[model samples]
Target chain A: MQKNKLIAGVSAGGLALLSSPAFAQSIDETVNHLFASATGWFVNFIFSPFPGTSFPWIVAWLVVAATVFTFYFTFIQFRAFKHSISLVKGDYSDPNDAGEVSHFQALATALSGTVGLGNIAGVAVAVGIGGPGATFWMILAGLMGMASKFTECTLGVKYRNEYADGTVSGGPMYYLTKGFAERGLPGGRFLAILFSIFCILGALGGGNMFQANQAHQQISGILGDFPGWITGVVFALVVFAVIVGGLKSIAKVTEKVVPFMGVMYVGAAIIILLVNADQIGWAFGQIFAGAFTGLGVAGGMVGALIQGFKRAAFSNEAGVGSAAIAHSAVRTKEPITEGFVSLLEPFIDTVVICTMTALVIIITGQLSIDPATGNYLTEGGRIVTVTGASGVGLTSAAFESAFSWFPYVLAIAVILFAFSTMISWSYYGLKAWTYLFGEGKTTEVVFKVIFCIFVVIGAAANLGPVIDFSDAAIFAMAVVNITGLYCLMPIVKRELTSYLARLESGEIKKFK
Target chain B: MATKYIVACDGSSASGRAIKVAVEQAKLNGASLLLVHVLEWSPYSFLTPEELEERHKRRNEELKRAQLALVDPLVESLSSEGVESSAIIRYGHVSETIADIAEKEGAAQIFVGRTGQSTLTKLIFGSVAASLAQIAPVPCTIVP
Candidate 1:
């Protein structure tokens, strides 16, 4: 045992040394690559012979898409926020409901999936890279994201299928295929297949690996020199135990864990803000000025705006169809009821948690650039670079600066957030995988095992390129999912009208 | 000999009522009470086996603390009333394990709290409670 321990320690140390240098070198190369790619994309978009531009131009396209979607939906997310709360309270619970889990449980489960590291680390990254001004744009993007979530979740419910054994299955794939089939669109099947493929890839990378990587980092950071494989092996085992039992197990675990973690993390942030009371005003000032003037460490106003918008988009994921899969499992006949509940996602994730993280970072004055390299510096003397994503290390520094001995707390929170995210994303990816690869138990196990393997890779390898690739995959999913939503908006409108009519007739109130 | 009833209770107020309702039904049917609580594993799935077990043990202890706080009082009250009852705690999923325990213990009735929907509606559309009711191969009463 002693010899094994020595060997293990040496191997881990050697691996870390080898990987760290490679990671550092690759980060520089990746940053240069991103700049070149962005430059090329921008030039092509501006000077192309065609009137149109590239798909993801300046990250403003995401904001504009959200804006257009919000207006087109007539601000459904804002108007229906309270109604969503009531839906979760089971004010509209009916046995005749066609879906599976309770609206509250579904919302909790879905929230568990979305409200992970994005809120903590992602927000920190945004503020670190974009400065205080990024916070303003994140809030703006979050507000608009509410509408996008509303549209997709409603459609997810409307097109769901119930099996003979009374299990409900639905998501973007169902809506994309069935909604289009209803409209006699020729390529509905093809688009659905494409969306499912992206969802599977996304689930494995963004959902699974991203989550495990953060959790592993936190554990290793706090506990000191634990083997990386320990995290992967243990994570896979625990995840396997739950997921193998299927959605019911996942739901039960999520319902309990998500609420507790959400309250705890948010409570901690609120306490930090209260402790740092004096700096709040100055933080707000910096945020506003940096937002407009683009005078922060990120170079210009456009760069700051892009970082904020990108982070918010990453954080809330309003356009991505992943959350809709979880929401679709809700037990409700009224699709709009679930949609109302879905709006709370952005409110809780971006509007509340992300905002708190931004405040904690900004108020702590950690958003300032280092005089040496123009990069943001944490209190711990580490130069905070904005290679791709900015959430984890920055948030940890902010919490540490405030609480002093609170790195453990932030680390624990990161583990819980990331772990919950991976488990929930497993469901999303599995659903997407099952949709495409056939829903055999064997196939699921294969996907899950592969997914678990990536957890180690994500933790051990440089995430700069991998996370970017995964983020792009998720964004690609959004592009496909939102297009499907656009095509199926009429169905959502009809479902909303029908549910509203039922509400007017006192049919829903009878349950109360 | 009267058949036993297994009552699965979380610490929620509704679950407290479920225990009360199960006790009353057991008394009426001349059945014994087997109170059970299931504690779920935490989301820190990335911990080692020893760590996972350690976490589970910690959670089990917490659950035991809650059970003692809630169930001990009820057990004492029932003994004072000259009623015989027992409590069992398991660490697993609520629905499937509840059904499994009911079957193993030869429970004639299964009682659970209706946290999400009312018993009547959940009966028709089915829920965790309804799923238990359908598959437990025994009568189930969901207490709201």
Candidate 2:
């Protein structure tokens, strides 16, 4: 009888909270106004100076770094591609090592952090703006970005601090401060502090807000118009439960979630592509033709190249320090193995997954073209995705072309993707927060609460400012991270050279 | 001692209980304790090449951790109790590995705990308790 009463009281409490007015329309508007305007300055400075070119130069450095790393590492992305796959498979993992997760789990976790809305909404946006030719550039960027990932993740592991509790603290902060100090380079401390600050903002913006915003957009598309704050509240509670305990529990959930969702998304894209298999040859032709001629797009080759490279940079996040943190926790004695394992992150996220999304959009006849200009017709506010408007809705329309009910599934998938990414970023942000302010329960709770609040704001607000600020924050992380990568690449090359030589000589035994 | 006993442990409360019962059995019957913790793993779970590669590394780490977290303390206590004891940590199917170790060590008896796995879990993924009854080479004790 008492147990029955306890259940009844809990149900009642839940109903009340669900219907609470405080979690409705009013809160959503307030949140939107607060964040969009506050981050205006950061959006400006990062994108400053056309310098005789119309290009937004902030992304140039990242692309340049990737290109340089690719050459400097002797196209390690190509040569070590098989080795990277093997490392991720745990081919050389030493079970006697200390760490919380396996190679695959670390890769999966980092992938989850990156492989969210970008694959769906971001792809649609890129294709809409850059045209079909963008797909070629995106693939190129993903390919080169593999080297950039190798450079940073190697340092992330090589310089990680293993505490007495057997837990690890790593990323640009550790590598910059310790690695530079060892190399007799100055400014490692300043760079680490700068990277940590950007990482925290990025965790809140790109990781939390951008995900929440896109999820809300998809939810609103399916469920019809509703208060963003309500969606925010539900998302916050779920994210808080996963993230409050930090990496261990978060890793468990993301490892499973990322792989399943990734396969599902890729599988769905493949199935859709197969259904339109007759158009397969024509689609590749359009991509290649569009690459050189730009067909009839306004900006021609330059526009497509910029958009493709930009989206690819955003998608894989090669030089960003966040994945380094996630990868550092894998149970492996050799730091270089984790580096090899991490480069696969971009190849999977962009080259494989994003390409599938692109093919589906093109093959399904969702992207409408302008006959006169030979460019994709843009009306309404959305361009990148199928139908009008960019984001998950556009991706949904492409899938809806194949299966009518897929929009609902896509909505749920988007939410799951967004949720997983948010939690992973929460860890990234939390680590940065802890690094800045010494570790303690009080500091953790404070950061977590702030992060949860942002989820709701992200859902309620206009996508433009939230995405703008997040893109800027994410790129800011790249700026600081790549700077550190530049100083540390020689060491990474030495480690790679030694590991590969030893591997070839049979000194580094493969356990399996 | 003429007799040897095998105890399957996982550092849980129930596993601690299994250890306690095994210690008493060792004291009463003049048997030695061989505490074992098996991290149940199957190569089939690693369907992809990536998972296969990490299998050995994962196995080594699991064994090392199990030895440190489960076997070491249990062995120390048993020895301090005037009961001769040793430990083994391994990665494989828990029931099969436990039984294999028991057979190889020539243990006269085996002990294990009723773990947190529910009735449905045991139904689908057969419990260590049920498997022991069918495959164990010696008499088995399921400590509650």
- Best-fitting candidate, scored by lDDT: 2
> Which candidate has the highest DockQ of all?
2
Model 2 alpha-carbon drift over 4 Å, by segment: A1-34, A95-100, A244-255, A371-374, A379-386, B1-34, B40-85, B91-123, B127-144
Per-residue CA lDDT of candidate 1, range A66-142, in tens? Answer: 78778886888777777787777766665223122456566666777778888887777667666777888888889
Could you tell me the C-alpha RMSD of candidate 1 in Å? 12.3
Model 1: residue A341 alpha-carbon error in angstroms: 0.7
Q: What is the lDDT of residue A162 in candidate 1?
A: 58
How many residue pairs of model 1 clash at the backbone? Answer: 5
lDDT string, candidate 2, B48-132, tens digits: 1122223445555666777777788778877889999888776667898899888888999999987868878888988887788
Every candidate's CA RMSD: 12.3, 8.1
Question: Taking the candidates one at a time, how many backbone clashes does each contain?
Answer: 5, 10
Q: Rate the local accuracy (lDDT) of all candidates.
A: 0.70, 0.79
Return the lDDT, model 1, position A460.
Answer: 48
**Residue B15 shift from truth in candidate 1, angstroms:** 16
